[model samples]
Target: MAFGQGNGLQRQVISTLDNQGRDVMGLDTLAWKYPDSSIVSGSLLTVESNHFCVLKSRGAVLDVYETGQHQIITPDKPILGNIVQGFFGGNSPWQYEAIYVQRSKLLAQNKGIATSKEMAIMEYTVDYYVHVDTKDDAVKLITHMPFAGERIPMAELTAYAGPVIEQAINQIVQVTPMEQINERIHDIIELAKGHLSEFLDIYGVHLNDVKVLIMPQDARMRELISLRAFGMSELEAVRMYLALKMADMGLVSAPNAAAGTPFQIGSSTLGTFDVGATAGLPK
Candidate 1:
């Protein structure tokens, strides 16, 4: 707690020291807000290392303070100082919100579904790292991202970035052939990292790293892709795949010849196979 003397009234001192304990405990706390908005002139604003303070009012970011102690009405910070001086007496308190934003890196793992160039549906998971790297970034985060509680947690940051990461993955997969996706996984991750970095720039966040893992959702597609990844030609891979027939228990779905049913083999559809009527197979 900090205090100041102005106009025979006590001005409040504010800092994130009260909440720093939670931050140090790996809570992933992103930003903490001072509970009261009635800020007084000449009050001390303490900004700790690896964090910055965003001064805002009426939903607008008025000023940003870096790692240092700032007198609320200092001459160097005209935007906030002027705003405070305009309405209240030189030494009176005014309404302003102070948001302290942390600079710690955040890691998030997100999964999404997308279709490849061959129209094979794929499911992918991306692990990414990001952080607010500058005062401008801190301002951008506070201005662009929504905050409802006393603080913003890392989970919310991940939630905001999940769709962006998935969108980047979709863009990459939509143009990559299924047969080549496995071989180009490293290239895909690099492209996704670049795309996510560029996408987060507008929000003042810097992406540090990204890892993506993609595989087709269809069982047959997964098998085919896995087989093809072993330097096998498409025909060789398909020929190597065995369609097992079960007698008691196996992966067999023999179509009923009486009903003339059709079944899928690999990527092809085959007509019904006729078995003798006395075969005694389940219909």
Candidate 2:
């Protein structure tokens, strides 16, 4: 499964083996489309979970878990677009306005810009606008428009966009079925509990407060705890756990709790132990 936002919309493509084991591809055409978009290229495969992996050249790979549900296996990193220089030859104000609106919306959706300050930069800068399409047969035209002296770096643009994207995601997650939401919540809590335990042991924070800080009425937290209780691997539990936590904390949001990178514990390793011992018998 590869998901992306481009040309002011979102797109999802699913690839699977056909009945005879040949590759089959499916897509949602209503999603965004970018002409000349660079293909994800690479070869190394990284396993994200039982249901997902990262393919070298492709983006994330999802494991089919239940009907209409998939475990996402991808990083939370933003994809950068190649910059090209070009001019739109036209004299029509309406066409220019359309192009500007489309470009601005695409940038906002993809880059995740949210702050008033950031938006101002985008709105006041010629560098951000680049060109305006005028007529159907204007051919090509170039002019030495004065540099507007204002620009947002690509990195800054991505940072600005991240939280906005997250907020949009949370809105969607809020409407997901309670059963699935709870499962993911439990998974996250369990991972956080483990991390809290370790952090307490190492830095000497009290266990009582750790529990309180990580426990609440959040459905995603509950699911993480359940995953831990069920003997899921620590890494698996943690990844699902973190994704949900980030979602809850308003850091990033995905369609479901299973989307995004696994939790990254600095130095903990999984051990073969009774789930009861590590997770504490389910409450």
Candidate 3:
């Protein structure tokens, strides 16, 4: 909290967030409002080591306090040892907005992503750790990151970054089948990491680490894999795939479909298949 004297009134120039006398936690950014748009000439500003404060007025960043405490006083000669000057104008008061941006690594997670339309309802999860990649990006992140209570939900952050993640995954899945994608999950994740790193460059965040934690969803792909595991030939696999896909497309009616006649088992005007050969064969 910063104490300032403005218009003969002493006010605490602190953030509404975490102002209830509780230890702050899980928040990425917090801000302070000047008392009635007034700032004392010489106020006590307490800044933490891992927190950076930005003072802006008229949409212009005036001074930045990276670390330590300052009296919030502009030096007389613009030379106050190592401190940056130009924050204070005169002995009266200064009006500006102060925002604090967190400088710690944050983890975000999202589960059950279907990369593209071609992908079935497969559940693949992504895990990543992110931090402010640059000072400008830090400012950018602080501006848009949701500020509710004292903390922005890590899940929300994950969702915010989901589009970039899914875009990267979709690029990889566009060329590869689910079989190969599932087999080389780690490699695909590495590709996604690279893509996400580039995609989030505008947001000023670094994808420290990203991975596909679990990849057990493609039902049809899994079925194909199971058939292969059971020593089925490639020709049989293709035939089975066609049959299943046809039924799935509704061209071949399901078991509950009405039959034309009593002896007509799966008798359709479209065509009749020799189910005898495709039935239980030599194992």
Candidate 4:
């Protein structure tokens, strides 16, 4: 909406304006666009510090403004003049888009699940930082990425990058043995970051850092890992496993009465063991 301000001597028409929201530090909004197409000839454009305001029309950049209030003027360049609609005298609307791009790094995190080489379900938490490096990079971002609505939020970028990270993790984890996953955490992170960086580079986003944490979700998997880590005797480990299975099947109950059957433990289907067949024990 265009509005008037100032005294009767001189009036100003602000076709569209940023509300100082983008200037605040630690905000999730990375970029914003002026929504109204009724831009006046001499409208005011406020570009905050650490930001760039770009004027684009028909997928072409007309002019770039940085960190100040710029008065709208039709580009005098021959190529741009052919694309941008002329600004008529007085308060007339012009057909051009004003986009503000913030130059700041952003952090995003996501949780996902993938199967390991041993078929154990593993939960993964990934934290990553990303940013658009320069004004040209920001322009490439706006050009390549799908911009919806008036502003771009941090969640959208995370959502776009989440699948790529997941695919990379799955590829790495699928080949890694379950017992070695803990020791290879650093390698997994580096590998996933490398894969994600290559994919995001085309869109002009830099992956600053990526951290990956993975844990087994299966109780049986945990027990096997403990046995391997602590170097427990084979007989002792077998006895302990048998005792746990007896309790799980309700053959042995805790010291409380009135219990028909104890709740089964570690009901997760991932990496489950059939005690009767695998342990050579009668059902």
Best by lDDT: 1
Candidate 1 lDDT trough over 10 residues, lowest sum: 1-10
**Model 1 residue pairs with clashes:** 2-13
Q: 1-283 in candidate 1: lDDT tens per residue?
A: 3222222223556676543343331447777787767675667887777788998876777789998888886332443445546655544343578888888787767787888898988888888777889888998877777775877777777787777777777776889887677777887788778877877787787888777888889887787667677876765555334322222334345323323344556986654433432222333
Sorted on TM-score, best first, the list reads 4, 1, 3, 2
Off by over 4 Å in 2: 1-150, 175-274, 277-283
Candidate of highest TM-score: 4
> What is the C-alpha local distance difference test score of each model?
0.68, 0.28, 0.54, 0.65
Counting clashing residue pairs in each candidate, in order, gives: 1, 29, 0, 0
Worst 10 residues of 3 by lDDT: 254-263
Clashing pairs in 3: none
Report clash pairs, candidate 4: none
Given candidate 2, what's the lDDT at residue 231? 75
Clashes of 3: 0
- Between 1 and 2, whose TM-score is larger? 1
**Residue ranges of candidate 1 with Cα displaced over 4 Å:** 1-10, 24-27, 58-62, 74-93, 155-163, 218-283
At residue 125, give the lDDT of candidate 1: 86
TM-score of candidate 1 relative to the true fold: 0.64
